[model samples]
Target chain A: MDQERIQDNIDRYLSGEMNPDERREFELEVSQTPEIQRLLDFNRKLYKEIEVWGKQKLRKRLDDYYSAYLEESDLDHDQAAQTHIADPIPAVLNKTPRILGARWWRMGIAAGITGLLVISMIFFIRQQPKVELTEETPAETPVDSLEEIAPPDSLQGRSKSKPGKEGEQPKPQQSVPGASKEKMLKSQPAYALSNIKRLPKSFVRAADYPQQLQYTFKNGMLTLYGDPLIPPLRLKLFRQKGRLLLQFADDFFFIDPTETARPLIQIGPLSVSDPQPLDESIRIRLANLQESKFTQSDLEVWTGTSPQQIYSFEEKNGKRALILGGLPEGENPLVYVVNGQTCFLVLGSSVFELDNAVNQPVVLRRINGASSANARLFEGSKEFERKVYKIQ
Target chain B: MDDNHLIEELRNGNEDVIKYLYEHLPMVESWIQANNGSRQDALDLFQEAIIVFYRKVREGDYSHDSRISTYLMAICRFQWYTILKKKTKQQESFAQINLFSGQDTGNSSGEPKISQEELSLPSRESYLKNAIEELGEKCKAILEAAIFLNLKMEVIAQRFNFANAQSARQQKLQCLKRLRNKVSYEYVMSLD
Candidate 1:
């Protein structure tokens, strides 16, 4: 009843319809009585409560709207650049802004940056010296590999395998944990293939990776970005007009490359500056030995015949990983960049963007065109180096 | 449009007016940067100022005699002062900038004075902010419509599917009452 009376009195006071006696009585009650004063104060300051609440709601809505606008602005900036490219060229001085718009000034500064880069590149290339082989250099040459480092005693017993047709996905190189060391070595290279003459569908190759693995290729290297939680992927990629289109299903996302991978074969030209789309088909460009044989000093490092084959098979509790052994320091295959760090390997590929740069471990079989030596080695996990020893 | 028409449009809850105020935010940036504030700080305070202006106009507490810039700058100054006071906990001298020139800000609503109750409880604002945030979606929308949008009771009723304007009004009051209870209860608990 008191709450009702208080609410009624407050309404009557605010409405300004109270008679003189009622008004005088209400004022006197409010002035002298603490409870009445408190009630009046709460009623009057309800506006203040609304004011604060409105500010918070408005701030969030505006900030989100502003960020989205900024993102759209970035796209507009890109389109503006494309427009300039399509338009006719004006002399350098004519391009200066009469009224400085945001886009114009931005493009002008970008042009200045490009000019600076060209001048800097000229000096950098001229001053750079050729790198020479030294005692400090690891993997000086593949020729002296067997002579310097004795094979791991575990791999002393070795044998070659019967070769299969080219382009076959090598069977899983099983490690029999219960088998004797001698038995394992005798059964080494269990399924041999002359060459991995073709690349399989991305999904087929992707089966070998942890389901969380995401892959993209740049500069002849296939990078596998990792998601800690391994959330469901909503990836979209398609070939439109010879341009490979890549897009994400959602706006809020990030790709963390836990490890990067590529084939260890370093074929002709090293890396193609402009690699064409390769999803439709795989085209292998065999190295031109007559021209590229002595053109690179790396080839001269290996003048001798092929070294004796060796095999080391260690299996425990069915751990799945390709154990990369018998690799000499020089011409180490596999290159990648993850989280701003780039590790370059002599992964044999004439072109990168195309299907030529093989990231699947199957390519490790046919690397160096040594089909007989392949079907033996495979790619290892990121922690492979830590688990095994490397020749110092 | 002219300033009078713009103000009128703003009072009627035009989005373009808000965008116009933010699109040309160099003055706010300059003032914030002149103090020890970043561009982000300028944007945040400017947003608050705009909200305050919108509320003042919607509540019919703003006088038409004062320029919009004067009123906005007043709000910005007050926001910055509040931020600085919270940061230091002690009274600090201001960096010299003409936040107000004693010109007519057209403030018919009583001065946005500091309440003694607010000063007495340091954690009150944060608690109020939290309680408002944790409110159910229905309560939030209803309160926002009643208080910020200041829609007609019938319009609010239509939007929320209420039987009548009176029911909508009752719901709005209940939400507000719930929020107040939460804010004060949390504040007193924290003090103890």
Candidate 2:
């Protein structure tokens, strides 16, 4: 048979549309022809995969619809519980196959970044002491409840931010079977950051305190430069695994003794409330720079190592960088940025190796050409592991 | 409910059944964690496992010898293991160390190396999906109606204003053939 005929037969057989005689002949021919058999097998697998693809898309659409419905339901319930028992009614009603949005690729990227952020969150849990709501601060804000917050449609999400009973960890959501899609919509797991305070503490803008703070992470201690009038508040925090996290509040920048953008390089807008976070990276010191992720980005930088390759960040001119462990010793691998805004390399790690190589930035060969991949750091993607460092 | 009933609910696409599956995510969560898989890995894998499980049950003669939760966990374990196996070059040694160290001690290191052909399955599947998306809005509507909604030819023909079920069957056949061609082209390009 011709290639076209064979292809059609394969399709017919896989689709379960073949007539009895046609099916018998095709099966016999398939057994005899190795290539034809492989084709049949692959087409069959592809057929099943297409079904799965459709199902996956359906699930995503359902998830979006259910989540939006749940967000509406949770408006009145301020004392946020960890798991919302799904209302069975909503899920059934909302199964009318609707594509949530055309930007699934973006969601996939955002999901990956969210995974990284979750890892950062796990790391955050280890370093920061549990958040204690000040007695005057209205109510205690626990991270558990904060994670469950649905984004406010019209500031309704804030009501849920109010701290739960003193120290009770919101119990892990238990599945209540027989719940309607309506219930599931209300009880969807906390997938996205629903509000502003839900942002991690580490990622707020560092430029908030221009003169009042000078944070330099070097030699295992965070060097802070604070205002002379106030007692210098220095935390003995150091960079971990070549990453340094600095936490700053919006109110901190409010008191600008000397109003100038001279020393305080603005990485992003320092604010408690904004649907979109800032998108900026500042090279505070050549060796160390802070990349504040307040918003989403289309292109993301990724570094992959061979399975056996062991590398460490080495301090080249006070900036610790991911240098191959066995490479012949050299200067800091420089990633050049012409415009202060659109940069080639932002020090993903907060902890910088403080050095005297201030104005002179080392430029390196882009041997491993910077490749772009889709990874959106979702809304409120910045800030994890809230640690305040005084710039000494 | 009995195990059989649980499987039935899954097959029926019960929202409660799906939600129950998700609630049991923490069970596989630990296994993924210890094996260097992230929470996101656990999330994606669990969902896929549930869908696969549902389809398997939807097929005839699926026995309910064990608890649904146990069965779900087993499916998740296999899915994750296959994913990891296809991933790492040193997966030969890695699979030996199972997600958790205790079970399946015998025939551990004797795992076979995944073939290039099998390795290409996922990318091919992804390519096939993209190809389907490019099948145009009309094709999407017709094909989705037939395959996803499981509509009969007569109903689909009337819905799309076809003259008769015969014409609709012919159109559906053509669509299937086109999809096969698109998927095959994608597979070949993926190999390249």
Candidate 3:
């Protein structure tokens, strides 16, 4: 093959258009002719070389093109640009007196809106049916038995005593373990937690916590708040023959008076007792004095049988509602004893919500059970209506 | 260095364009030297070719009908050939050519034959470019359109307003011969 023909064939091959026969013939010529072979090899090398050089040259060209342009382009101060963006803040601040005046006007509008909202809330709350506390008489307490002790028929509708005026629930009765009601009364003015920082003097060495012990001798009611240790553990102190009880979800566990010596209500993890042991646990009655004043009908039924069988503090309305059964599997209830009067319980879902984000109540239920053990909350439509409580 | 994103940035006239070019220039210059030319020559040639390409492109004379590389290479080819032409003319000797300019122009209906001695020059890239630079403009354009752009001989003939591809091919051969002569002269000069 001649040098020119050979060059053409190499170009054809590079372009991927060489016919098979042409390729075979070209290969034969390369093998037989040293000069043509060398030329073809050189052409291949140059084609690759030039293609690379071409790109590099273009890139270098592009750079040079821009370098000259940029030096003369006239758009270069980013720091000044930042100052311009930030200028709005000072501009807003320069109008501060006017803005403050405008803010006062906004405040007036906000107050009016807030007052309207409060009025609307009052109306909405009044519209809701008054949650009548059901007073179920025990099998033995005949109606005639307590007729002399009972209040007039007009007050009979409110079995757990008449609902107090708005924001005027029964004041927590102050009853320390050893202090007499009269001494508790004499110091009541000082012990009363008008300021949240002060604890009632009844607690021997009350720690700096917002805990107060209120004991009502007339109703045998005791309320606690702040650290669980302020008041004795036996919440049944408020009820007749009241014992220290732990309610977990719908499961209830009685503090074994035989096993547990220290009555100071401690908030922490609860041990798991055998399910059967819990079943056999004795159910004690509220004190006779408390029972005599309020019939079994007036007593709120509490069945303390949570599925996990652990204990947590729960509050319903203003009353401390110790739960026995509404616990989620694999977890225990978080108990909060507030001022020794109310035990505020957060269920697992509620706990999870508080942990994950700002929480909103998703579903609400009203459950009532015996001994606080029968009441349980089954989440996600489990369909077990064993005394559920409405948590608003 | 040939990152698609950088190419995009360059096209968009981004502020980083200057820095990118500065960093890449030496590498590009080195690559050209590795490919064929000496370092200094490659740098000068590449720089000039790029500036010409950039000027034409910036002026919008480059329609982008062909690749940026192809356009730039065309400029590089012009610079390379021009340099070779100047060099060859300075040396005086008997010039050799690979093909006759009028052989394919309806000469004889037989196999186009070439002798071993006549076929001794390197491929067009190795020697043909220098040889072709010595040819007339008609031959230069004909061969350039055919070889660089890979235009069909008929298309090249049409593009140059020639009679036909056979005639175009005949013209292309004469161009190849002229390139060989220049190469022969360059070789003889180097021997001295």
Candidate 4:
């Protein structure tokens, strides 16, 4: 039999497309021929591998669902804690005031008798004469007087009540200077500072006076103004979550990369120049920013780096992720920004987006093509060698 | 979901079943930890148990005589015991023996008793896995679509933009040939 015929028979046999007669004939052929049997064995093994692949695909989906479940559970717990523990004073204060209905007449009689007794006692005390102050006398404060006047049973009840236990007295709100401001600062999401280093003096002069700088890219070249001491610094543009972020030195600015008239962004003291035309590379890269579907395995293969650890952390989307290691790193770690399902790859200053790159190595293979294009543009410049930041 | 519904979902390979399966992890974890296993060990053992359970369900070997939690716990206990027995070869501690004595361990059904060999992937399968990955994206997709997903050749051709079912079949065969060569090369290198 021809190899094609044998392959067809094997495919049909494995797919269960054969009848009993065809299956029996195929088994006889397999029993007589060693080569055909080996081929069948290889196809069977391949079939198993495909099954494994399917399982892995299923596992990936399960992992995603599990991550979302954990995130949701965590959020629910946090919200419950906030409602019950973080701020409870409002809950206590919102209770309806008790109405003293039937006991009002009896309470009026008791109050009239107490008022006559207090009037007689005050008259008696005035008649006794004033006491003299001495050096050793400790002044009786209002708090001390109130404590002395409090009923013994109420004092006992106060002593018995534990702090933070049910029915305990609400804590008095203490005023701490700048505490709210500090909390606000703490609550804000902090920029990742591990990969950012202090800008070298060569990049920007410390004495430059401008508070805001505007820069533009025209024909693949960056133009800056105001600071003659400043050399051409490498800039990285990437998308975090859904916003475009530009990073240079230790500072990053959120910008709308699509806007034709770039907004004046404030960076410390360096002023940047505006070019007559936008760079074609930046325009192309901005247009390419989109959602991608690269799997954990594809990331491992392309970057040639495995995660040092697998753990969960809350992402900006308010979902917890079991992220694999820090980020993509290597000579040319294609995708620099991976936020949820979106991925962006950096080639020099331009950022290109990759979509559904998993099981699609061709998208990643384009990195070589993009890199060569960058190589031709920047040739021998230090900008070509700058490490791409792996911003999570 | 009830056991019947869960079993039906698992048979359909619905990934939502994973969330349901995870509900059983804590039980399995506690059992493994009780048997001198660490949390990580419990996690690894439980994951293997889940895979075994999933495979059994897909293969229609799972018997509904026991609850899903009970079945999963049995698999975890059996796997952990096998691991401990291997680790401490000579000393069969009394606790380990007592742990399984009264337990069902899914032996009643005689279908879900997973051995260590069944839990772990064979070395050849690992080699085949690497070879499949090395087969580039398109070839990998074609093979998986045709064989694993049981997708029709016509559907595979349409999805992959092939000219026809015949072309898709040819492409799959070509990919299989490359994979065979790669696996053989890897086997030869391993021998050396």
Candidate 5:
């Protein structure tokens, strides 16, 4: 045969495009001709290698997905720990009654004493001259005036300083006590100094904010910095194949401090797109079998009508065995070997097991059960189709 | 997603299935670690079992009678058992050797020789891999699209910017021919 003819025949045979008669003839030709057989064997090996390559690609993808999962899980754990640390009141409340009673009595006595001192101080202050009170008011005046005049952007450059340092440069006065610090910072932009306490202990405030809020990470703890009004943008820290990455939104950015010009190099999205739709013919065939209710009588009728459908039936060692066939060519029964024993046979997308001890009827019921389950899968596809149609 | 939907996704080589499959890893890891295997061993073995499971699903052999996790665990256990047996045999063989003796095994150099696993691969597989690699990137892409992805000749043609389906088919055949020549030459050379 010419090379072209040989290639064509081999493609057809391997692709299962040839009918049984054609396949038999081709096999005969192959067996007789060593050259053709050798070529055919090579093609088969090539196809197998291609399959292995595809599986390796899948394994690589799985590794990535697993890494992403681990990162997210770690982030969750840290967040949970932070939440626990934020609220210690419940834990205190859960203490033993004897310890709680003593602590509560002590707190009550301290509060009474504090209330008496506050009343006496108020009376004494009221007795003071109006000029003296005015002199003290300037100390608090800088904070109120700064809060009114300072633009939100100016807050970024305000470094921590002593209370009386207002004369040097208009900075946020640290002298304010109680709610004054919170009130002052609240008027500022999203990355206020007060918000620093909200961050995890491992994250150090960035030395300079050239742009938006930034933090330098100490440990592997992820640093989240964004507008408090809106939801905080979570940047998951991921270590993949020895390279550090920060996942923000749908994209992953490489974390390399050395690359100061572009510290975060944009890596492509980590998520894999949904797989392509299954083969149309396979889908249609599966859909058609959605309502098939196979029973013992149905099996018997199928066997009687077409002997070829019954792949094989034999008696060995006084034990009868039956193997149902008549599936599409190249789609043989799927033998599921579990625990080193063939436990299940999935034929025609329906499952059945071979048991010599059980009668045919019992085996038939099991087949029926498995077939019904298989049908349900198709039913799910039908529901999906309906949803798609509705959307259209 | 349900098991059936997951199976369908797996058949299409979807990566999302990996996340769902990963949930079962901790179980396998704990089992392997308890059975005198390391976390790395568990990971490698789990990946292999998943590949086997994927092949089975593609071949239409996997039945929904059992859950995917149960099936995976069974495969892992079976594979781990096989590995343990091999390790035991290797240990027995090592036990037979007298390391305390002053005699040298072979070379004077203390450095360990590269094992077969460290090499490219088995001779036949390496030959095939090298042949495919020699086919060049474009040819590999064409072949992968045509054979692995099972794309139509027309689709392959458009994808590779060929003149038409006929040209694409011609290119594919040409690539295959080159691959075959390389593999055959290597086989002939090896035989000689």
Candidate 6:
């Protein structure tokens, strides 16, 4: 290819328009011809320089525009107006489809101005869904009470099945089969079971429950359903204090204390309080089941030839407590712990456990065997050894 | 939004799309400035182009035969060229080179010795920096659609409603030529 022709193809190539044959030919000439190569390099640099200059200039102009806009609208001075100016355009753009139709653009400056005005509030309000309070009323009383008042749709949507628009006849209540009305009424000791009909199937508790009884995971909540005579109760478990504070009605019923409690469970960094603590209520439940949980003060890190780092410990109370982190590097690693009287061994992401000493001691071995099991960290150990760790 | 989805929206004259375009005006401006054009030039070009695109799509003039980026790039390139010629009377050498390259046969002695790197300009970071700095929202959009998005001329033209693919192609050629003209060849060559 001649220098001029080769140079023309170079632009096409940069713009990614060159056909495969032309591209191949262009590449061939570029290697053989130094002048062409120099020319290509110059073109490339020129394109890049212009691109960078354009972006920088654009950014400066945008900043200036935004500042001027804010100033013109008096948003900079007005605290309330500042909210709109500070609202991110990306966020508005992202939500354009879900909340506003594409016609949002046609509304022009009016919509833009209005949207800007409400931008900060939109973000703040969107993050919080209206929390509906489920009024806990006694189910034993058949007569309609103020507590039985249907929550407004503004707060919580009520079923259309309710008879009468506002001051309607009370609808027939139906309790799920097997869970009798008496049993459902006595489920929660802290609050009166208001509308048993509204209770979800999973929320339905066994009619008869033991008063001073051991609780196990049923469905997904630690429910205490008993006789209606049982007064309302309040139970708050604090991890730091390691105590279970239970109050019935106005009186403090019991204070079952322990030593291993953690902060409340949080979904994200800043999110609503996760009250559904059946599986998540491990730390609090441990207080009721186990007399005391024993946790090792120091955390030991297990490192080997592999990059995997494992930390294990034990809290042997009533329930086996194993704290484990960092395991085998593949998918679906299992965790288990064997309990003993004196020592608590914890296995984490790694599916293995072992008993160790300065010399040779029995080690807990993982049950699952693999092709490369021997090559992994823990290959051999006794299965029955007491390896205790805190369970999640 | 997906390009096709956006095209549909634009065809429907969705207000949100228009608003979004207005909001991202700075991006188009940046693209223009990056390609050796000015913010004001980019604004006029982009505004006109988008409206034209909307009208075309509304009028069923555009067929979904090509990627949206390609068509819009074509229009933006053309708009840019018109602006460039008006700004600078100098005959754009890059455009001439582009026209010449199309007719000129590639290297006859086909060999594997040639490296694609030899034909490449500097990394996008260097020369385009100043232009990008001068860019507004519309310019940035046009540049990114053409350069970063690597869209075809026809698609961009259709998206932005340029007259036609050929005009779009010519326009892109001219814009690039303008940028080439502004570039300091001596400084760029010294980097080697």
Best by lDDT: 5
In angstroms, give how far residue B119 of model 1 lies from its true place: 14
True contacts kept of 1: 0.13
RMSD, one per candidate, in order? 34.0, 28.7, 45.2, 36.3, 37.0, 33.3
For candidate 5, write residues A103-194 as lDDT tens digits: 33222222222222222111111112212110111111111111221111111123222223233221112122333334332223111111
| Regions of model 6 farther than 4 Å from truth | A1-8, A17-25, A68-274, A280-392, B1-145, B148-151, B159-167, B182-184
Measured against the true two-chain complex, the DockQ scores of the candidates, in the order shown, are 0.06, 0.05, 0.01, 0.10, 0.08, 0.06
How accurate locally is residue A55 in candidate 4, as Cα lDDT from 0 to 100?
A: 54
Query: What lDDT score is found at residue B129 in candidate 4?
Result: 71
- How far off is residue A339 in model 5, in Å? 12
- Candidate 4 lDDT over A275-325, as tens digits, reads 222222232121111111111211111121121111112121111111212
Candidate 5 similarity to native, TM-score: 0.39
> How well does each candidate superpose onto the true structure, as a TM-score?
0.32, 0.32, 0.22, 0.33, 0.39, 0.27
lDDT of 2 by residue, B25-86 (tens): 67677777886675555656666555445544543324433345545565455444434532
- Which residues of candidate 1, in runs, are more than 4 Å off? A8-27, A30-50, A68-392, B1-17, B31-38, B60-136, B147-168, B176-192
Which docking category, incorrect, acceptable, medium or high, applies to candidate 6?
incorrect
Clashing pairs in 1: A139-A330, A167-A197, A263-A347, A264-A333, A264-A347, A265-A347, A265-A348, A266-A348
- Work out how many backbone clashes candidate 3 has: 68
Docking class of 4: incorrect
Superposition error at B38 for model 2 (Å): 4.1
Error of 2 at B54 (Å): 2.6
Question: Best TM-score goes to which candidate?
Answer: 5
Instruction: Predict model 1's lDDT versus the native.
Output: 0.37
Q: If the candidates were sorted by their lDDT against the true structure, best first, what order would they fall in?
A: 5, 4, 2, 1, 6, 3
Q: Write the per-residue lDDT of candidate 3 for residues B59-171, one digit (tens) a residue.
A: 22233322334334434443443334323322211121213342323321111223232233234334533444556777655554544334567667776788987777677
